[model samples]
Target: MKAVVITSPGGPDVLQLQQVNDPQIKDDEVLIKVAATAVNRADTNQRQGKYPPPKGASEHLGLECSGTIEAVGSRVSRWKIGDQVCALLSGGGYAEKVAVPAAQVFPVPDGISLTDAAAFPEVACTVWSTIFMTSRLSPGESLLVHGGSSGIGTFAIQIAKHLGIRVLITAGSEEKLAACRDLGADVCINYKSEDFVARVKEETDGKGVDVILDCLGASYFQRNLDSLNFDGRLFIIGLMGGAKAEMNLPTLFAKRLTVQAAGLRYRTPENKAAIVKEVEKNVWPAIAAGKVKPIVSKVFPFSVAAEAHKLIESSQHIGKILLVPS
Candidate 1:
């Protein structure tokens, strides 16, 4: 088994490809021969020694992978050996093989290729959990997504559009805004040139958005509060800008807003299983029907995972980036 290991993380250059022991599968787990993995911000953070793996998780950097089941545990029944699947992992996705809890795997849709499926699990689960499960965003309501050209943002915009919600996205450039617009964003605000709160207000004709998927934590704290309508819910999935913004109590008191932050990897196995199940049942069908698909930015071999990390860290990719286990 080959995997990318971070030897005292500092930069992408620190990632070393090495042959390691294959993971041993538990009775409740499955052994997957990984085909591809997606590069995530979490992976870059881990490489830079910022984000550490959860307790008992593998030290490898990847968070999600698409692969074929080489073997199934005794307790597994829903799948068999050679079944194609994509899995959401707490870690260890940057490897040739991974032993994962069977509950965390989902069958790839018919139209989705094995490599492309690697991009689905993380963003799909993140968007579904934050927008539908946590925030409870409903049809006809307005939703704002920060980092609109990001992997999660692209999926969020498409999902919101499919659910009949008004979508607003914030990006730093015209190119990013245009990408988001093409993905069905109703309003795109160049955060570099315009105040998103004001633009959101003007677009909504005064009422703020009903829900916001925010990645810029402390920096957008006050603005996020101000951009919410009465009883609005804000779901924080990442703290990209920084994590110490001040809150306005008066604004919260007046609008009765709810603020919640969640990390998909920190969730319990059962919770992730539930999310995977739901995504399979509700989201996979749409993907099979060609109603939804992730926009792929690029693909790189597993040996050059560092290059993938560098690309994502540049924050210039318009969509998901895939890394094949070559």
Candidate 2:
């Protein structure tokens, strides 16, 4: 199999295409012939040696993929060869083939293209797991998402809207904020031009948001706390801005806030399966109905995986940047 391997700890240029042995299928796994994969922050981090794959995970640098099942393990019953599917991977998605637990895979809906399905798993699974599974965001409540035009943010905004939640988002620029508004964000704050804490308070009539989905980590930590309602759940999915910051203990105590940080890859197989189950039940229906959809910003050939990494690093895209494995 051919895969994008990290030649050394460095920039996107470190991602090298190399011939590697095909992953062997286990009794409960499926071997998929990958069609496409999406660039993620984790991938870039892993390429740069800042993040490494979890123990026993593939050393290849991809977090999610969509493909056709080429073979299934003897114990796998839910999927078979030739099934079009998209999956959240623990790692190793940037390859010609991957063997994953059957429980982590879900069928692509009818009429959805394979490449588009590739765009779904990472962001959809991330947002669904964080907001619905972790935070338990309910209808009519307000949810704020940072990096509003991002793959996860765009999906979060759409899902929050579809579920009847009030959505607020903050992006670096007005153009990105406008994109978030188009995706159904009720309030789009230009973090550059406006103070998000003030804008959020104004929009929610001083109540603040019920939840916050953040990836900015340290840079937004103080403001994120200030922008949340009492008992608000703040799920931090990345450390894009920085990793270290001081927190106001009094503010956290007074608000009774919940601050969480996690990555999908480090989750247990059971946890990932549970997230997949939730996505299959609640989010899949929305996808089938065209209510929630993957937002794809661009597509690059598999050979240009390095350039794709640059795009994600620049935060220039409105949604996912896809790599079609050829």
Candidate 3:
């Protein structure tokens, strides 16, 4: 088997494609011959030695992949050999083969190719868990997603709109803002030029948003608190801005807000499996019906995974970036 390994904690240049032994599967796991995998910010952080995979997880740079089942473990009854599937993984996606728990694998949704399916799991689970399940965002309630043009942001907008939620989002450029608006975002704030808190407040006539899905941790912390309506929930899944920030207890108490920060990579397998199952149930129908779809920014050959990492670091892409095995 061939996989991308981080030679050192640094930049994209540290990634090296090296031959490694084939993975041995547990009784509840399946061996997948990977067709494609997608990039995420976590992959970059791993390369830079910032975020480490959970104990006993693959130490590779990918978090999700779409693949074909080459072999199934004895205890795996839900899937069989040759089943085409997409999986939410805890690492080791940047490879030709990966052994994954059967519970975390899902049948590719209708109207999607195996290659494109690689981009779905991580973002789907993250957005669904944070915005819908955790925050309980409902129809007619306004929700704000930071990084509106990102892979998660793009998926969040479509899903929220499909569920009849009013979506407000922030992006870095007009080009990105236009792209998000086309995806059904009610208000698109250019974070580079405008104050998103003000934009969101004005859009809601000072009522503030019911939910905020944030990626910039501390950098936007105070402002995020200020932008939420009473009883609003703010979920943070990424910390691109910085990890530590001061919180305003006065604003928090006054707004009656809930603030939470979370990540998927370190979650227990059972926890991840539950999230995957719910995503397959709740989000899949919309995808199967063509009401929602993945936005792929680019696809690169897996042998050049380093190039893919470079692109992700550049942060110029509007949606998911996929890496296909060469």
Candidate 4:
């Protein structure tokens, strides 16, 4: 099996493709012949020595993948060999074959192709967990998403709209904002040229939003807090804007706000399995109904994963970027 390995902490140029031993499965895991996996911000961080895989996870870079089951473990009765599936992995989706716990693997949706299914697991779990499960965002409440054109943002917008929630998003360009609007975002603000806090206030008649799905992390921390209404929940998932900031306790107390941060890759297997189960039950039906769909901006062959990394770093794409292992 050929896998993309980081030679050292640096840029995309440091990634190297080399043949490695095939993975062996454990009793509750399955070995998949990977058809495709997608590049994510976490992968770029790992390549730059900023993020490392959780203890006991594969060193190769990839968080989610879609493929066929080449082999199944003894306890895996729900899925069998030859099943078409996609999985949320801790690592190793960059290779031709990877092993994952059976409970974390998902059957591809009824109408989606395998290549596109590769884009589903990570964003689906991330958005569903952060906005719905953790924050408890309900219908009739307003929600704001940072990085509106991103994989998570696009998916979040569609799901919220379908469930009768008003959505507001921030992006860098009009083109991306237009795309977001087409996906059902009720309001789009150009973060480069507008004050999002003020805009959000005007749009909501100064009541603020109930939940915020943020990826910018610390730099936008204060503004995010300001943009919240009473008893708002701030869910931070990415730190693209750096990670150091001072907190204002007075405002936090006044608004009765809740700030929570987490990463899916480092979760316990039981937790990941639970989230996967929720996505399969609550989200997959919407996908099968065409109310939501995978937003793939680009796909590169596994041999050219470095190119995929470069695109992810550039941050110029509208949605998910994928690498297919032929």
Candidate 5:
């Protein structure tokens, strides 16, 4: 099988497509003949040698993919050969074939194309596990999402709006802000020109949002705390803005806030399986009903995996970018 290989710790140019051994499946895993894989910020980080795949995971770049099941292990019962499915992968989605735990695979939602289904698993599981599952963002509450035009942000806005949550988002440009509004964001603030903390407070009548999903870690940490309501929950999933930050302990004490940081790639298989199950149960219905949809910005063939990485790093695309096997 051909897979994108990171030749060194550097820029997108480091990614090269080359022949590699096809991944082997364990007794509880399935082998997916990759139809499509989505590019993510983490993939770029991995290419730069900042984030390595978890122990025992595939060395390839992709974190999620949609494909046909070519083979299923004896321990896998829910899926069969020839099932069209998308899966949440720990790594290795960049290859033509990947081995994944059967429990992380999902049936493509009705009305969604098999290729587009590749965009859902990672963003869906990330948002669902962090905001809804851990933060307990319920209906009738207000939520703020950073990088509003991103894959995670786009999906978060639609799902939160569908569940009756008022959505506010921060993006870098007017075009990005407009896209977020069209996707059900009630408040769109340009992080480049405006103060998001002030805008968040203004939109919430000075009380602040009930929850905040932030990817810019240290740079936005204090501001994020100031933008949260009493008893607010803040979930940090990425550290794009650097990782070190000094927090004001008084703020936490005064507001009774909760701050947490987690990612899906390093989680135990059982934990990922549980999150995948919850996503299938709660989020899939919204997608099937046409309330939530995949937002694909572009698609690149596997031969141009380097270009896909470049596009994601440029941050010019508004949603997920996909790569199909060449």
Candidate 6:
């Protein structure tokens, strides 16, 4: 098997494709012949040695992939050999083959290509688990998404809008904001020139949004709190702006706000399976109905994984970037 190897803790240049042993599946897992894998910010962090794979997970870079089932374990019943599926992986999506728990695998939505199905698992599970499952973001409410043009942000906007939630997003550029608007974002704020907290409040009629999905952790923490309505929920998934922050306890007390953070990679397989099930039940329908779609910015062959990483780090791409095995 061939996979992208991180030679050292550094930039995208550290990624190198090389031959490796094919993964062995456990009794409850299945082997996927990778068709495509999506690049994520966490992959970059892992390459830089900032985020290590969870214990017993594949040390490779990819977190999600779409592929054909080459083999299924004895304990796996729902999936069979030759099933075309996409899976939520803990790691090791950057290879020709990966072993994953069968429970985390999903049937590709009707009308979606097998390759593009690679874009859904990570972003879908991340958004669904955090805001909808935990924060309980319901219809007729307003939600704000930070990094509006990102993979997670793009998916979040469409799904939220489909569910009747008013969507507001913050992006750094007008082009990015325009993309968000076309994807159903009702309010778009350019963080480079305007204040998102003020804009969020303004769009919600000064009451603030009912929920906020933030990736810029520390730099936007306090401001996120200020931009939330009373009893609002703020879910943080990444710390791109740094991890440490000083929070005003009074704000939480005054507004009865809830601040929470989580990552999909380190979760127990059982937990991830539950989230995957919910995504299949809720999100897949929207996708099949053409209400939600995969927003792929670019596709790179596995040999050029570093270039894909560079594109993601540059924040120039509007949606998910994919890597396919050559």
- lDDT of candidate 3 over 1-326, digit per residue (tens): 88888989998888888898888899999999999999999989888898899899888778999999999999999999999999999988999999999999999999999999998999999998888888899998999999999999999999999999999999988889999999999899988899887888888889899999999999999999899999999999988899899987999889789998788988888899999989999999999998888899999987788899888788899999999877
Worst 10 residues of 4 by lDDT: 301-310
TM-score of each: 0.98, 0.97, 0.98, 0.99, 0.99, 0.99
What is candidate 5's lDDT per residue for 219-274, written digit by digit as tens? 99999999999999999999999899999999999999999999989999999999
Please list the C-alpha lDDT of all candidates, in the order they appear. Answer: 0.90, 0.89, 0.91, 0.93, 0.96, 0.96
What is candidate 1's lDDT per residue for 102-189, written digit by digit as tens?
9999998789888899989999999998889888999999999999999999988987898899999999899999999988999999
Q: Model 4's lDDT to the true fold? A: 0.93
Span of 10 residues, lowest total lDDT, candidate 2: 109-118
Q: Can you write out model 6's per-residue Cα lDDT over 1-326, one digit (the tens) per residue? A: 99999999999999999999999999999999999999999999999998999999999989999999999999999999999999999999999999999999999999999999999999999999999999999999989999999999999999999999999999999899999999999999999999888877777889999999999999999999999999999999999998999999999999999999999998999999999999999999999999999999999999999999999999999999999997
**Which residue pairs in candidate 6 have backbone atoms (N, alpha carbon, C) closer than 3 angstroms, thus clashing?**
none
| Deviation of model 2 at 116, angstroms | 0.4
Better of 1 and 4 by lDDT: 4
TM-score of 1: 0.98
What are the runs in model 6 whose C-alpha is more than 4 Å off? none
Worst 10-residue stretch by lDDT in candidate 1?
285-294
Query: Model 5 clash pairs?
Result: none
Clashing pairs in 4: none
What C-alpha lDDT, on a 0 to 100 scale, does residue 179 get in candidate 4?
92
Residues 86-114, model 4: lDDT tens digits:
99999999999999999999999989999
Tell me which of candidates 1 and 5 scores higher on lDDT: 5
